[model samples]
Target: MARHVLLVEDEANIVEAIRFILLRDGWSVSTHSNGATALDTIRSVKPDVIVLDVMLPNKSGFDILQDLRADPAIGNTPVLMLTARGQKKDRDTAMAFGANHFMTKPFSNSDVIDVITRLCDDPT
Candidate 1:
């Protein structure tokens, strides 16, 4: 089965970049820009991996991660949190909220593809 990836990011450029990278790597990529509706999209899509942005409209990625961790259905879904800040505090917060990995913005295409590939290979 093709691996599914849910990309929750507001920035258009980042979205396009990650989408292109993952798609080229043979992933089924779905995108959501609004954090408030992100959970609904996730539930509906049931993606194999999630690429989430830290700052979002309506709700923050931290809040969404907390909610996902609390839900039994999707609690174990691997999440890779993205942040433009690239600060230790931001990375630590993502870890505390149960994100499986953290990557800063302006990330290398190779890195994103490689990480997503690994996350998909991990057993759900």
Candidate 2:
């Protein structure tokens, strides 16, 4: 079966870009626009990896990451966190919250592809 990715982002452009990239790479990409329902979507889909944004509606990505880490069933799933603010503090916070990888917005397609490929291939 093809690998699955859950992209939790609110921006239409970003979602389209990511969806195109992942779909081209032969991964099944499912998108969730609302932060309030992101976790529920994750539970339903059980994606192989998750690409989450820092800013979102209803809930912050940090809060979602916290919930994911707290749940033993999905806690170990690889999470690649994206942030518009490239501050060291944001990166630190993501790491502290158990994010598998951290990425800044305006990211190159190749970079995103590389990170997702790595995460799926060797999700540790």
Candidate 3:
């Protein structure tokens, strides 16, 4: 089966671009503009990986990451957090909250694809 990804991003244009990239790479992608809805979808879909944004409506990516880690079923799931806040503090905060990886906005599409592909292929 194709790897499935839950993409939580608020920017419509960014979402579209990332979705297109992931789809072209042969991954099934589901998107949510709000973190609350993303949480619900994550529970239902149990995607192979999550591409989350830090600035989301309803809940922050860190908050969602905390919640996911608290749940045993989703705790170990790979998550690649995307944020415009490219600061050491922000990156450290995401790591503390259990994000498996982090990427800043204005990132290269190829890099994002490579990271997600590696994460999906990891057995752990």
Candidate 4:
């Protein structure tokens, strides 16, 4: 089965780039821009992986991750948190919220592919 990946990011260019690369790498990619509706989209899509942005319109990525962790149905879904800040605090917060992986903006395409692949492969 083709693995599904949902990208929740407001930046147009980043969304395009990640979508293109993931599609090229044989992933079924879905995207959402609004933080307000992100959780609803995620539950409906039930993607295998999620690439979430830290800075969003209505809610922050940290809040989203926390919510995901609290929900049993989608709690274990792998999440790769993205942050433009690139600060230790952001990374720490993501980990604390149960994100499987985290990446900063301007990340290499290979890194994104590799992390997603690894997360999918990991049984626990």
Candidate 5:
């Protein structure tokens, strides 16, 4: 079966671009602009992977990651954090919070695709 990816990003243009790329790569993509609704939506959809943004309205991606990890039903879900914050501290914090991978904004589509491919291939 094709992998499913949940994308939580506030930017319309970036969401559209990433959606286009993920869909073209055979991923089932679902998108939401609000982090507040992300957890509920994810529980319902149960995506194979999540592409989350650190800065979001209602809640931050780190908060969402914490919530996800706290819930046994969704705790093990792989997350690829997308952020405009390129600082090492931000990346380190995200990793410590359970994000499976991290990518800064203005990232290459090829890199995103490659990482997601590898993440989905892992036996976790």
Candidate 6:
């Protein structure tokens, strides 16, 4: 089965880079840049995985994650939180909010692919 990914990021360069890598790796990709409507997009897209950014225009990724976890329908879908700042607080916050994995900016393409692959493969 083809895996689908929803990328919620605002940076054009980062979005392009990540989209290129993920598409090259054969995953069908959907991109969304607004945080305020990201949750709605997630519900509509129903992707296998989500790559969410920390900061957004109207809403924050942390708030999105928290809201996502609260929704029963899409709550369990794996989330990979990304941020330019690699602070321990961000990682901890991501995990505490139910992120499956957290990655800092400038992540290697292989690492992104590997993490997504692992997230989808694990049965838990």
Tell me how many clashing residue pairs each candidate has. Answer: 0, 0, 0, 0, 0, 0
Candidate 6: give the clashing pairs.
none
lDDT of 3 by residue, 1-124 (tens): 8999889999999999999999999999998888877777888889999999999999999999999989898778899999998999999999888888999989999999999998888824
In order, candidate lDDTs are: 0.91, 0.93, 0.90, 0.91, 0.92, 0.92
Candidate 2, residues 1-124, lDDT tens digits: the string is 8999999999999999989989998999999989988999988899999999999999999999999989888888899999999999999999999999999988999999899999989977
Q: What is the lDDT of residue 40 in candidate 6?
A: 99
How do the residues 53-76 of candidate 6 rate in per-residue lDDT, one tens digit apiece? Answer: 999989999999999999999999
Write down the TM-score of every candidate.
0.95, 0.97, 0.95, 0.96, 0.96, 0.96
Off by over 4 Å in 2: none
lDDT of 5 by residue, 27-122 (tens): 999999998898999899898888999999999999999999999998888999999989999999999999999999889999999888878788
Alpha-carbon deviation at 94 in model 5, angstroms: 0.2
The lowest-lDDT stretch of 10 consecutive residues in candidate 2 is: 68-77
Residue-level error in angstroms, candidate 4, position 21: 0.7
Q: Write the per-residue lDDT of candidate 1 for residues 1-124, one digit (tens) a residue.
A: 7889999999998899888888887789999999999999999999999999999999999999999999999888999999999999999999988998999877888898888888878733
- TM-score of model 4 relative to the true fold? 0.96
| Best of the two (5, 6) by TM-score | 5
Report how far residue 112 has shifted in candidate 3, in Å. Answer: 0.7
Q: Which candidate is the best by lDDT?
A: 2
Q: Any runs in candidate 3 off by more than 4 Å, and if so which? A: none
- Candidate 1 achieves a global lDDT of 0.91
Deviation in angstroms for 24 in model 2?
A: 1.0
In candidate 4, where is summed lDDT lowest over 10 consecutive residues? 115-124
- Please report how far candidate 6 places residue 84 from its true position, in Å: 1.0
lDDT (C-alpha) at residue 16 in model 4: 98
